[model samples]
Target chain A: MDSELPPLLVLGPPAVFNIFKSQYPHKYRFLNAFSSDLPLLQFLQTQNTHPSSVRAIFCNQRQLVTADIIRSLPSLGIIATSTVGYDHIDTTECRRRGIQIATLGSQFAADVADMAVALLIDVIFKISAGDRFVKKLVPFKPWSFPSDSKLGGKRIGIIGLGRIGAEVAKRLEAFDCIIMYHSRNKNPSVSYTFYSNVLDLASDSDVLVLCCPLTEQTKYIVNKEVMLALGKDGIIVNIGRGALVDENELVQCLMKGEIRGAGLDVFENEPYVPKELFSLDNVVLSPHAAALTLDCFMDSCRHVAKSLDAFFSS
Target chain B: MDSELPPLLVLGPPAVFNIFKSQYPHKYRFLNAFSSDLPLLQFLQTQNTHPSSVRAIFCNQRQLVTADIIRSLPSLGIIATSTVGYDHIDTTECRRRGIQIATLGSQFAADVADMAVALLIDVIFKISAGDRFVKKLVPFKPWSFPSDSKLGGKRIGIIGLGRIGAEVAKRLEAFDCIIMYHSRNKNPSVSYTFYSNVLDLASDSDVLVLCCPLTEQTKYIVNKEVMLALGKDGIIVNIGRGALVDENELVQCLMKGEIRGAGLDVFENEPYVPKELFSLDNVVLSPHAAALTLDCFMDSCRHVAKSLDAFFSS
Candidate 1:
């Protein structure tokens, strides 16, 4: 192994982790926004010429990697990213190139599920509005009381019965929320009733949770049509992805009381707010932070470090 | 019973179906409020003269009815409130007066449990804080991320092992939190450990929930000593009563990090935030509205109505 060159190429944000960089600065090189263009690619290509070691590729959940970038890493043996979804990575190309790709699992399941639960309570109890009164740094605290709904004996329909969805079910069990889920494939072990239609699940559930992956089939799955079927007081919580809900339709339904309220962790576009969401007091919105936390990031670092260690050892 | 008057005298804020003088319009002849303590005892003596009607009395969870008041209601066969806690009603006085008292029971267990779970998520995930920044009529959508703290593999302690505590435990079971509990009397049905000392329970649990009733012995149970024993980063949730936690010590401990944070519904002095807690952001405070949901309260009304029907029929 070359002693002078970096042992790995990490493709992600360069947080100021003093311990990590100081201890192994020479062994790790970061490929951030500054290192992804044509000239930088040429420089990285030259850097990858050292036969004694390979560069390790790292990306976050959001970034898109190109085929050219994957091809350039001739010495790349491992691809690691801090996410459960690796759709951004060209898995087919990586398979052909003899590369081992590793991504995060449900390390954020409880956290995301917790966020979903938090949103459910927020929408139900008006936590977002209460928070506003707290922030104006208000002169007086509002006389906000508990709302009109309870989770118990209410049907909770969950879409995309994956890791986080299952975790939500398990947690809601304590609250006595009836579990109703619809997924493309049935999970026999889960014991939740299967609904043939997503709208059918929506119609029955008091709270409809969006946990499905972003695909053409599931796009705008909770549109105006679905919300109407769900009824006027029904709640919608989306923790999986933004595109799964039709933002315009959701806002309209909320305004007209076709659907009661929504707790949204994601939106159709990144860092943009739909105008209609602001008009309704029934919705609670976060900046797509369902999987962001200090603990989960710390876990991710450990996972990435282990994967890198294994790759080097191999 | 007189057809003109509402049968029950609800002593506090009324729901849509639950009629109380405070929330009722002035036109509503059936409801009336006593301002500045217009001798409710003396008035009840006069009202009870009509023993054929007004079979029961209802009060809000916060209303203070002294022993003298309970002794005055000769025809008050049943005293009911939509809460699990009955300390406000002077239950001893009711027992002495031969007045049967009833409160909402196991039906609201999951609802209260869900609130506890919601508060936990609110405190840990910073849900309230995040929403305020992102959607709270704020100038900018400050970049926010979801908190990633998984609920698996943490020791959780319940101070009371009653219906709500058991419900909370069952809900957390799927999340894999090690459940520990301490109550004066232990029930054999639960699998959780029965810790005798509050300090031991505080030391062992990652989260300590005060679900026990308020009694002279249980008052200020989570004082400075218990808070200190909890250590930094340990969480506390109070769904039982504010008196169960010492406000002064809790403020000091929270500021000093003796305990991590608190998710509180009840307060020693409610709606009156200790200036110290307002200064500190480590606590998530609710307006003692844990079990005051519309559905739960309505259910309580139906329960009381049914009990009244049966009691009167006999």
Candidate 2:
């Protein structure tokens, strides 16, 4: 409502955009794209009398900041996403334009890592399965449920020992899990064993957890060979992107019993999970909502606000 | 099968009894109650030609070691249970008869703690709820799923600072949760803040986890007043006995939204969860299988065997 406040463009829905506006109520004047019936670019141009005044773009995971959108914002100095992953943004265009980008970064790392560990334990111990069994009132028999694998002393192979992976390792350490990891390069500070390749990691691990960023080089990283290497008793947990794993291969592996089980938070096509996964008892499926907690959302809002303030001040 | 070996009575089903027998076949001569067509008491008397030779009883959670059963085994020097909880055995009678009792004490602590943490995270983060949402193809609308509470920085009150509770506290510490606890006595060794009463503990905690042994004093420990003190946003995780919390009161609390949610591994009546819980989204039900992992089972077997050897040799 204050004209003197720098104009900030918001490309997300009102629910998320409102949080940003409320977080920095007087710091910046928010121009919400979803508020108007006009096209995003047209809305952006008309909402702010001086288009060049709109210096920062606040976006969410659902909205993509394409090259066209980025080109339209002539004076856009920085893009701050309320998500850990920045793949939704056109980084190439931003690089060419010399625009800065800031992500939620480690703000979501703890929450996502919590989810990764939750899924891993759920799958391994059949927590959800047992819940269903009890709730459904399945007949009680000797060993009615399948025997679950223990979390302690299991060889856990973490893919990408970034902030989230490191947090997962830290939490699982109390369980006495033997931790090893596969990252781009070895993290000398961490004592966990490192494997140069995913295949070797899978071969040695009882559980393979995907925590790396999704990129061109890392797409479909957990392929058929990796799953096979993980062996019949092995399990996979992906709190990262669905594309990081070959979804079809994963499905096939689960169906044919090539691998033991999987705990998936993200699917190849989100909100469009394979119908086949619905009936399987071995897999635990979560909506792509590892970082959807109220705390994480609030933290992300604060991170975005801080980034905006820092960028403007700089 | 060796007649010269000390006789050990097994009161579980053939499936579970077989695991114990095979674990240490040469160590003791097993007299399996399920193997015979007669009743357990008749099998105990008839199967063992010399009833006085039965010096130990190997039992699982499903079977109760009643006062009569203990009295029937005239020479029963010890009862070795393959479970952490020994409530199934009449401790009064055991004490009266001067019979030693050995339980799988700390062997299953890590596994049970793992389950407690798993259930807590699952309930707090709505892991299973999100899984159901994705699996059921609930239309993806913005904020369709309820926002979840984060694990980090929450006040967690653990009931009982025993081995399992200690392990739980240790694991949760990595998540940055503020751990406080209530035990029969203040645990001087533990740095966690101890509340002298359950109500006080419930009032201060966002999550109240039951890890205490069920006893006359502890039965229905979490009553209406305690649940009320926990308030509308609090969650309860029970990896302890079913009767520790008043199940009727719990169902009412959940129904009336007195508490946010519950993650229950045990019930007032297990294998027969309250039918009402089946429809509720707030609760996660597990069929008393928290310590039912194959690793725990194997470890329990080993513990029982060691106890037998120790008791006999002493």
Candidate 3:
């Protein structure tokens, strides 16, 4: 801990903290909350040795930076997160306080988009299901084999036309899919047809991809009516937060074949995926790791470092 | 069985035969060889009731149309296959006999390319592996979770830059991959870097995708040397024919950790995947059904009918 260096509070686990230290050494003297025995608020109070010295906080997905934490750190002027979504942070309060917030925007977009497409194709084509079928050496009969739908010309409804949603749209265009979208506001640059609400989008779409952020308005956005409107042959892909779709409704839809399938990378309560999904061949589950690829993580670290450097230089 | 329709010889199992018949009823009276207990040659003889009446042969992947079959069908003027690859058909013999061949050309390209990208991302990101890991409730720890490479910024070497290969390149380009290719002859239309030989391409690429046709020149093209050149962290995706890669050498390389992983839609033998691959988490296998999506199949049937209609009208 060098007193001459700027104090930066880190509120993540060891893996990311260690990477940050190794990649950007001596730039900031990091006080890791995970390594500290005291509560995060008390830890912040201890770091306030020199008044207004601790001007930066670094966090990842594992920690929440609430209004209380913000009030406790009076010197904190900037919060840089290494994750794409900033729902874990109190963005409204931060905005009111004039505290600058930096996120790994568009860095995880490509990888997350890739995962979304991967899961969609996997579900529609039964790629993972087919792999399991073959690996189990179930009798090899072509006629008896499960059939899968083609991706071309399918109606794809994207929930958000932001960076990740746009990337997904671009990739699916090569497959000749008909792209439609629903967003907070219509993007003028894209030619994709926009729907004002999720219900109409689901009614017209064969597949609904959720790439929007999770907020109070967005939580449980894909309710029973939306799923029912999507129809029996429809599919859903969520690379965004799990809470965007009602988990219980989604489970019922899958079980009753109300929807054809789902490709999920996020869950309502992560690391504790519903056991029901395990037996369903139509659903593909990932452990909330859509953006955990090596390149994305490394790029995120670089982005965090650059944001910190820019903030201090300013 | 209608004598008024043009006689067409059908050779394959029932699955594709049923689809073709349902899609194009009364276009051509199909002579079902599989329905008959007699040999395929004998079946062809039975169909040759009127000389030059049986002008076309329709076949799928399950059976072969050898030079002998071409000689046996003296009145055969064309062969329209419901598959993308013509390796099962004696193309040279047909060419020498002045018999025109119509294939499901570029019809399956998009679907196959979709499968190729699906498998590549699956291998690179360990999507299937991660699903299995979570499904099995393997103890949850961030560090213990499998780490996967990213698709963006990877050097992707394509074996053939034809219809399917070019489609693959186009899709991978969206991921920010640097595309290089090896083909029988360089395609001047595209600007992707071309290598005269695969060895050089393998050395420079982090991933090698095979989309070339299978021929004597291409059989076992990916041998031990090529795998070694690709190094231990390399990935190979084959949406082409199985014999394009030396299966034995590939299994050894994977077992010994000479290469990173593989995404195989085809195998050296149909419906008989390498048993060793069953235990490996690094490889993703399909039952030679990359282009067998329902849309591709329906489109292929239409193509075959169109070709037959044109041939008769001419």
Writing each residue's lDDT as its tens digit, candidate 2 over A77-128 gives: 8998877887779999999999998887876788889889999888987877
DockQ, Cα level, model 3: 0.48
DockQ of each model against the real complex?
0.44, 0.60, 0.48
Show the colliding residue pairs in model 1: A289-B146, A292-B146, A293-B148
lDDT of 3 by residue, B90-171 (tens): 9889889898888888867878898899999888877777777677734444433345577888999999998899889988
Ranking by TM-score: 2, 3, 1
lDDT of 3 by residue, A1-314 (tens): 57788888888662356667888888888887778889876776776644356798898766779998888778788999877888889998899899988988887788889889999988887777777777873444443233557788899999999999999999888778899999999999999999999999999999999999999999988999999999999999999988999999999999999999999998987657888998777888887778776566677788888898899999
Model 1 chain B lDDT-worst window of ten: B27-36
Kindly indicate the candidate among 2 and 3 with the higher TM-score.
2
Tens-place lDDT digits, model 1, residues B1-314: 34454456556543323433334334223423333255664454555534335557666665776676565556678876666777777878777778877777677777777777777767777776666556645445455443335567778889988888888888777667899999988778877888989899998888888888888899999888888888887889988888899988888888887887888777786556676665444567766666666666567767766665566567
Interface RMSD of 1: 3.0
Best by lDDT: 3
Candidate 1 DockQ category? acceptable
Interface RMSD, every prediction, one decimal place: 3.0, 2.0, 2.3
Model 2's DockQ? Answer: 0.60
- Top model number, DockQ: 2
lDDT of 2 by residue, B133-246 (tens): 667734444434446577889899999999999999999998999999999899898789999999999999999999999888999999999999999999999999999999
